[model samples]
Target: MKLIKTEDAVGHVLCHDMTQIIKGVTKDAIFRKGHVVTEADIPVLLSIGKDHLYVWEKEEGMIHENDGAEILCSICKGDHIERGNVKEGKIDLFAECDGLFKVNIELLNKINYLGEMMIATRNGNFPVKRGDKLAGTRIIPLIIEEEKMENAKAIVGDEKILEVKPFIHKKVGIVTTGNEVFYGRIEDQFTPVILNKLKEYSTELVEHVILNDDHEKITEAIVNLINKGADFVICTGGMSVDPDDKTPLAIKNTGAEIITYGAPVLPGAMFLLSYFNGDIPVVGLPGCVMYSKRTIFDLMLPRLMAGERITYEEISKLGHGGLCLSCDICTFPNCGFGKGM
Candidate 1:
């Protein structure tokens, strides 16, 4: 590329998009890249403070900004991810279906650390609806060495840098354990919360049972649901360490592999997760999930529905952004309640 005075650039092509900003009115590119500058266009270009401009001049080893952005988009494009057109040396990506979005943070960091380009996205490991914006790729300059983009591709190797796994339909069962709720002293409010959350996903409530804090009964209920072809089972209440809290013991008696009994997150420290026969998930939700607008359950539900296994290592990382601010107007899933750096 070469810089020339705007007046003598009548026949030259613009190397980059020229943006004209008018506060909230508009902030769009008035002169797009590769547009041949005409005599009539000089005055308007000058009005936007374009005294001089860099005109496109093809070089053998260098690539244009838009081309670099295309490479970045290619790295991020995966199943259920849609790519947008290059605009102002950037490309935006969107979700093609409702699913859990994931980022290959290791490769992403290596590419970012190489400099000259960037891929910005919403927090991963969360639910994203169809047409939701997933990521945007931007090149820092109007031109860069083609080798740099090639290096990024090499770093990413055979795998895409990001992914969106569509949520799988799940057959669910609920075990509501608590003496008060079982005896009808208090309403079964916890079941309503679970049901309401279920409305967000593709889930069928195949089984539901209300019982006192009995380990044997809770264990029997969980196994029965699994035998009935439940994709997963949720046990609510009786998760604390109190003497009467037998839910944890019941889950153990069922012989399900317990991934973790507690998480390092607020409002969800007593949560438990296990898998029966190595596949069907069984979870014990703390009482906080019944009342809190967002908790560990909300953070992990999308992944669970998508059939992603949650390891103890993954749960241990939630401490960074697990504290919900409980804002007056809570915009959950959009907020950083479970997105750790």
Candidate 2:
């Protein structure tokens, strides 16, 4: 690219988009790239404080910013992700379905460290809706070294840096274990809370059983649901250390592989996660989830619905940002809780 005085150039092509920023009014590209500058366009260019403008010029080892942006987009695009038109040397990626968003952090970091290129994305392992912006990629300069973009692609290799795994329709079952609610002595609020959360993923609640804090009964209920083709089982209450809390023991007695008995996250430290016969996951939710709008359950549910087999190590990483601020108006997923886990 070559730079020429705006007033002296009337027939040259613009190499980059010229943005116009007005306080509280507008910030957008007024003159797009490759627009042939006319005599009357000089005054408008000067108004935007453009003393000199960049014009397209072929340079053998360098790439135009527009092409560089496309290369960056290609590296990040994966299943259920859509790309937007390039603007100002940037491309935005959107989700094509409501599902879990994932980022290959290692490759993302390597690509950013290579310099002059960047891919900014939303936090991974969270739910996103169709048409939501998942990520954006851009080249720093109007023109960049082709070798730099090549290095970025090499860092990503065959793996996509960004992906949106569509959530699968799972048949869920709930077993609320509390003597007060089982006998109808008190209203059962846990079932409604669990149902509402499942509704967000389009999951169907296949069966629900209310039983007292009896390990044998809980175990039997879980087995019955699984045998009936329930995708997974959820046992609420009785997950704590109290004598009456036997949900954890019930899940253990069912011979499910316990991935974790407790999490580092607040509002869900007593949570239990296990796999039944190495397939169906059985979750034991604490009482906090019934009251708190967001918890460890919200963080891990998307991953589970996306068919991910989470490991204990991954759950252990939740300690870093597991404490919720409990803002007056809870805006979960957008909050800092359970980030980078």
Candidate 3:
């Protein structure tokens, strides 16, 4: 790119977008990139205090901001994503479908570390709806060394750095294990809570079994649901350490590999997670999930629906941002709960 005086820039191509800002009215592009400077445009350019303007003048071994931005976009664009129109040497990526957003942190960091460019994105492993902004990319300067962007592409390799994994539509089975609710001595509130959460994803509760605090009955209910082709199973209540809390033992008896019996998150610390037949997941939720606005269950449910595997290490890492403040009008996920995981 080359800098030319606005007075002598008639017929030169604009290399960048120039903004016109009016205190209370507008802040928008007045001159767009690639606009050939006309004789009449000189007055407007001068009015905007453009004594000199960067004009497109290609130099060997260097890339213009627009091209550099495109390179950055290519590095991160993945499945179920749409790229917006390039404006001011920046491009925004949006989700084409409701899914889980993922970012390759190592590659992202390496691209940013290349300097003279930036790619900002939302936290990965979270739910995003169609048309949600996934990321934005731009080059810092009007021109950048071509070699730098190529190096970033090499680091990104053949695969893109960002992806949106579609949430799987699955049939869910809910088992409420509590003596009071099983015998109709008390109303069942846990079922509704679990049902409401399940609605957020494309999952249907195919079967619900209410069993008294009996490990054998709970185990039987889980096995029945699995046999009936339930993709996910949840057993609420009786997950605590009390002698009567038998949900953990029931899940164990099903021969499911227990991913975790407990988590470090508040309001759901006594949570239980296990996989049945090495595929379907069975979750034992604590009572707090029925009343608390958000819990560990809320944090990991999206990952599960997206078919992402959960490990003990991943659950342990949630402790850093696991404490929920329980705001009066909770805006979880938007808030800082379960961050950096």
The C-alpha stretches of model 3 lying farther than 4 A from their native spots are: 1-29, 32-56
Question: Please, what is the TM-score per model?
Answer: 0.87, 0.87, 0.89
| lDDT at position 46, candidate 1 | 92
lDDT of each prediction vs. the true structure? 0.90, 0.89, 0.89
In terms of TM-score, how similar is model 2 to the real structure? 0.87
Q: What TM-score would you give candidate 3 relative to the actual structure?
A: 0.89
**Error of model 3, residue 140, in angstroms:** 0.6
User: What global local distance difference test value does model 2 have?
Assistant: 0.89
lDDT of 1 by residue, 1-341 (tens): 79999998987779878999988899899988866789999998998899999998768988877778899899878898998888767999999999999988888888889899998888888888899998888998777899999999999878998889999999999999999999999999999999999999999988899999989999999999888989899999999999999999999999999999999898799999998888888999999999988888988788899998889998988899878888999987677788783
Which candidate number maximizes TM-score?
A: 3
Error of 3 at 39 (Å): 12
Model 2 Cα lDDT, one tens digit per residue, 147-245 = 888888787788898889999889998999989898889899988998998878867787999999889999999999999888888989888899888
Sort by TM-score, top down from the best = 3, 1, 2
For every candidate, C-alpha RMSD to the true structure in Å: 4.1, 4.2, 3.4
Native-to-model Cα distance after best TM-score fit, residue 188 in candidate 1, in Å: 1.4
